[model samples]
Target: MDFFTAQDNARRKTGRLVVLLVLAVLALIVVTTLAIAVAFYLMGDQSTAQADLSAQGMLSALSIELVFGVAIGVLAVVVLGGLFKRSQLGRGGRAVAEALGGREINLNTRDADERRILNVVEEMAIASGTPVPSVYVLEEESINAFAAGYQTNDAVIGITRGTIRNLNRDELQGVVAHEFSHILHGDMRLNMRLISILHGILIIGFLGGMLLRSMRFRRVGGGGKRDNSGAIILALGAALMVIGYAGTFFGNLIKSAVSRQREYLADASAVQFTRNPEGIGNALVKIGSHTLGSHLQATQAAEFSHLFFGQGVRQGFSQIMATHPPVKERIKRVMPDWDGRFEATWPKQPDETDAPDSLDSDERSAAGHRFGSGAEPGTQAAVLTAASAQTAIGSMGQPDQRHLAQARATLGALPEQIRTAAHEPYAARALMHALLLSEDKATRKHQLEVLQQAAQPDVYQALMDYGPDVLKLDVALRLPLIELALPALRSLSMPQAQHFRICMERLIEADGQVSLFEWTLYQLLLNNLSEQGSGPSSLKLNDLQRECQMLLTVLAAAGQDDPDEISAALNAAESELPFSLTAIEDISDMRALSLAVERLRRLKPLHKPALLLAMARCIEHSGRILPAEAELFRAMSDILDCPMPPLLSEEA
Candidate 1:
């Protein structure tokens, strides 16, 4: 789905959610009212005494009870809403991906399978005009894949080892396209919201379970209460808990209904995207016939069933509250002639004794060959032709197989070196340096050498020309380059990776300020890298400190005229740095850097250049420029490349 459709769907879901919430509130109000009436009716003697009491006293007593009941009911709703908001379903989905020990595979890696997966995802992203999501591989034998994230920017796609081993390129593409459909249509967010809301509705039931266990323990210890009032209270709590659980049950039913429909949509979208129903249909058939059959044995599988390419969790409750459509029914939709029985004649496991000789040999040999090479020339040509053919055959306006093939070819053409370098820490740094250098032949040559040495020739050239190309063309080309390059960069070592990130920050602050596009790109790069590095070590802020120091220097230079202003700017900028600056040495005096720059901008806007120059000086204080630090300087120079500075005379 496109942005508008996704937005409309979200608005519609929000409206429906609001209506449901309102109904829940009304239901709570009605239930509370009835309970209060019942309570008053049970107080027969007290009611009579109250009637006989002074009018004011009776009024006060009734008022207090009514207030308490209303307050409790209102509080319940508020608490439930808050619970919904804080529900970790989305986070849980991410956690599952992380627990699977999935890492960002380098598209340029020597591993052909990993490269193929990367290529397909990138192709799809480019074709769809969306940012390529980070891809991870789970080590499990289950033939399962899931898409998870609260937003497109945060989304991740994970596939299992079984899937990698079992499915061919075409089949894998179909599975990936299916997950991308979910991301595109905003289904992941809705699913997360549903998890949260349902959690809220069932909070009381969880509490009830705890309470019952505690009561059981008390009884065993001979300390359990047996008074009539206590029994009544327990019974009341149990009843409310049951009722609350019913709410959860119904909520899940609703989620199931919604999810099932989306599954159909995704299946349709996948077929459309690849323009090959057989590819996806065959994948489904394989899942049914395979030993794993799409079932994930992971304890946390149920939480992510809705996000999976197929059902990952099996339970009696799942049938009633399943977030996926039945596999048979889905298969039937794609292949009407498909019987309910598993296709026993389908290809067997790779090493199975009974496996067909033709199938086993073909697969084994194909797996051994490099991606795009093993295929017959005619087949490749046909795929390329089909991929280029843009027939809108699916409900979601899927492109023809030719278009998909073309996409695949485009991805195949990306240089392996650049792809490898993208994951290196130095790639982004190198790209940043190249992008900021003066257009002089010597500088350009130096930049090229740096990029070549950094091992990203394709990307280096691309970065060098990106700005000019962007200026000449429109913003459309930018997404393709970024999408193509990002996954490769994700494969970098942590410290090396951090260097690129630091480079990005400096690039953003190159001119002593950031443009909207620059800021957006910076945030996007950060988020993309962050997802790849989900571990504690990956989350370390060491490189971020270095970047802040570089930024402070830029700010200091820009605000150098007035000592007080520079000092203040240094201090503020230091604090405003993206990571912890206090812990870093020599940055204690940089805290007011941002404030000083702001004050300077307010007092003397045109002096921005001077302030920026001062900041650069601060960054260069160590005398000889480190390669990484030099990149920062290059970035600043590039941002000021316009209007062309003249060569200075030696005498002057």
Candidate 2:
């Protein structure tokens, strides 16, 4: 699916999920109320059968207070359970990895398997114009991997040991691409919501299980207390057990309906991304033959089964509630000519010699031109050159084979020191410092002083040393350079990361006036490298007028030279939005602009494209975008997880 269609589907699915959740909650209330009334009926029975109360009267005897209490209690439990789970996951995708015993891989990792995955992840991130995501390795010897998080910046990739040891490089790339599909298509957000809701439903089962255990071995003392109270407790406990499992049943049903089809779509998207059906197709064939296949043994396997590359657990209930489509079905979709023979065995060790053929020289050179690498030396990419053209989606979340080739060349073009620095935490922090350093000699000296005071002495020295090289990097490479530094930034201890953020803030605002370039760099660091990784907020921002007006004002002011041009650009952008912007103004104050971006950040995916269009229009107000404007607009889009391809003249 295209960008808008994919976003539309996500929105519609959310509505469908809400409707389904409401139905599930109503089902719980009805079942719970009946169970309670049955307990009361059994308690009353033998002697006063029809003498006092009818059956309707018995259900009617279910008091209004008790009914309301049951309804409210169940609803509160579900809501609270969902909120608690969401909160726990809010710690970021790292929590998802930790939940299943996945260990974070270091950026400077020497281990071949670890290095390979990190490289693949980095290439994909750069190709898609996203921040490089952190990678984690699960110790289990199962051929499965998953991408998790609320959005792009905080996203993490998790894979099993078997996946590393068994799959060749091309197969691994296919698997990674599939996971990336989930991230780009807005699937992760939906998955997080599903996880929270299902976890909430699971609370009922857990509570019932605890009650059943609590009743074990209690003394059978007094006849009255044991007979009367024990009977009621027994009935209540049994009823809860039944209700809990029922909730689980519906929850899984919802997960199945929501999750199964997405797997197929991801598979197709992976092939589209890499332009090699065999890459992904062969991986699935191997999964079919491997002993572990994709089944994970983690206790929480069932919890995140939907997130995996394949079925992470054995199917039950006629495969009706399976989180992924069958392996055979998936492979056939990618390879229509397959004769259904699974690969008998996979290599025990990953082999570099057998990697899938990458781009040929012609393909590489062509990609270099499209990606700005093959252009004249020092000429930056026009990734967001036209404010208007860059704003409209080209392959917004979809990067084709050329992007893959470009990513490979891009990684290869990095200087040795920068590449090496990107692999270590302290050195990586130094690189970040250097990227934010001022070009003005006086300002640069002051920034260096702030870094020495706030960061480690060694890092401060390294930052100063890399100053020349960092300054020489082309504008187009800056985003990808910072993207490479992400995993290293993540490797720092929590305290260290916090200190880095403090150091960066001090360095950027130290001059008292934040330059547009400095602000963009600051936004990137703040959003991605913070102690709390960037995640979707719980707030819902639907009033697009106020938000778009504010955001467009900042964008308009940043990109346009003339006041009239700024107004015209803002008007053009808002015209595309689902809202009106009647009072567009030239907002030059950086603080006000930053606040506007922060406010607009919480908008759902459907509204963001409009804001993006407005920003592009504003930036192109001069009829053509300059390199500086292009980079700043790209940073704005990056913050919103809106990936913009390199802006070619023809794209306009």
Candidate 3:
């Protein structure tokens, strides 16, 4: 999907979520307010009868109590909003995940069949321009897998032992692709948000439980002779507690409804990415027939049941609240007229005999043979080219088994070290440096030291050699490398470490231009990095003037130039700063330049003028401004606080 389309979808969803939250808060207030009002009315009647209090005095107290309750409810929602933004609930869930010691997984420990699962995940991640998420193995023999994290960088993919042993490479790839889709499309963040909101709703219930326990302790300690006031306070606490619990239940229902739809979308996206139905279809069938049946043993699994690949909880009510669709329905969507059964029999113990050969002999034989067969070598080459393209879609393509076999054989040509480095950034860096090194040992050692000192030895080495590798690669090979590097590149602190990011950007543009993938990566990296710190140096009037002059020189050399376009671009960029562009021109000194740049750097992503300057640079890079540049310049002008110059006016 296009970036803007994806962004718009997220914005629309966010708007809906806001509305839902507001409605939920309003409902909560109404329910709690009514409960408190009832309690106040009852207490007022009792006070009037017991103490001969005036009706007016009792009514005034009840009115004050209602106002106080409403104020408290509003305060609670405001506090919850703050907590959601801070992601307190997600942090708590992660703590629970960590406490379960789920991070440790022996990826290298393999039964002959299980080893291929790792290989498939690596291949897909390399193809998709996403990091290979950390994979965990659940010892249970249930057929299931799950993706968890607040975002792509932190995401983890976990699978039951049964999935690895039973599924082939293609099936495993289908499942992983499905999980990766969730990571890519912003579902993980929403999932985390739901968890935090639910936690806030449940806090009142927990407090009520605490108060109830305290009251019981006091009554027991006092031999059941409690103060009448204490009894009244206890009743009030009990009522609040029950009402608070109702809020929690309502919140969970909403969370589950939203989660179920996201799960369906993720499933469809998985199919789209892999173009394989039977792979996921068979997986569902296996889960249905298996004895364990996709149930998780972890207690926290119930809380995050909706986030899993299948139902993690076994409760009947949980099935109604399930985040995922029924397995039968899921399988039907993927495979029409398919008999729902697990073809492979489950073993009482882990079986070694059923493992398939890692390398098929016939596939290897075909790999060693010539590229062409019969009917003219050129025609054979063309057919092979078409088959290779279709392999990207996996089993859904028209390619026969032989084509799949041929594609599998190509995997052997890649270095073992490169494959091993797929999920490990540190190891990936060492491998990259080794690949970059030439025959000169001394020069290589010096370069390695420089990389090591930079604290990104792997990425630095990879960047140094990527230019040469890009030239050597065909379209197929180049695509995988770009995908593989995305996760690794994300690990770096681009905003805080400006020099490192500059080096990366320079390398990506080394061939004198950036591709669509490179541009996407740049933007993604910038967005991620900007969250951590003050971003890259911002564009100021002096900086823009200098860049504009550089563009003018480049355009002039090409013999077709527009000074008006150049002036307009500079004016538009400078107008984005908080301070006036004209004011900076009046100062025209180092201090002014420094202050302007600093202010620009501090601007929010929407307001930043540097992006405008960058767009202008991109437009003028070909030695002339495109018509599109004017629209970008104008959009940026509207976001800036500063006024535009008359020389760069649209009429001009």
TM-score of each: 0.59, 0.86, 0.63
lDDT tens digits by residue: candidate 1, 81-160: 54754554335345547754666554446555565666667767655545567778877776788787765545678888
Go through the candidates in order and give each one's C-alpha lDDT. Answer: 0.52, 0.77, 0.50
Across 91-205, the per-residue lDDT of candidate 3 in tens digits comes to 3223334533454344454555446665665555443434445566666666777776664445667777777776666677678767766665556656666656666666656
Which regions of candidate 1 are displaced past 4 Å?
Answer: 1-3, 21-93, 99-116, 220-237, 315-320, 344-402, 432-438, 442-479, 487-502, 505-652
The residue-level lDDT of candidate 1 at 257 comes to 59
**In candidate 3, what residue range of length 10 has the lowest lDDT sum?**
643-652
TM for candidate 2 is 0.86
Candidate order by TM-score, decreasing, is: 2, 3, 1
* Position 486, candidate 1: lDDT: 58
Which of 2 and 3 is ahead in TM-score? 2
On lDDT, the candidate that comes out on top is 2
Q: Tell me which of candidates 1 and 2 scores higher on lDDT.
A: 2
lDDT for model 3: 0.50
Residue range 47-160, candidate 2, lDDT tens digits = 553465566756754888878988998899999999999989986788999999999987777787887788788888887777788999999877999999876767899998
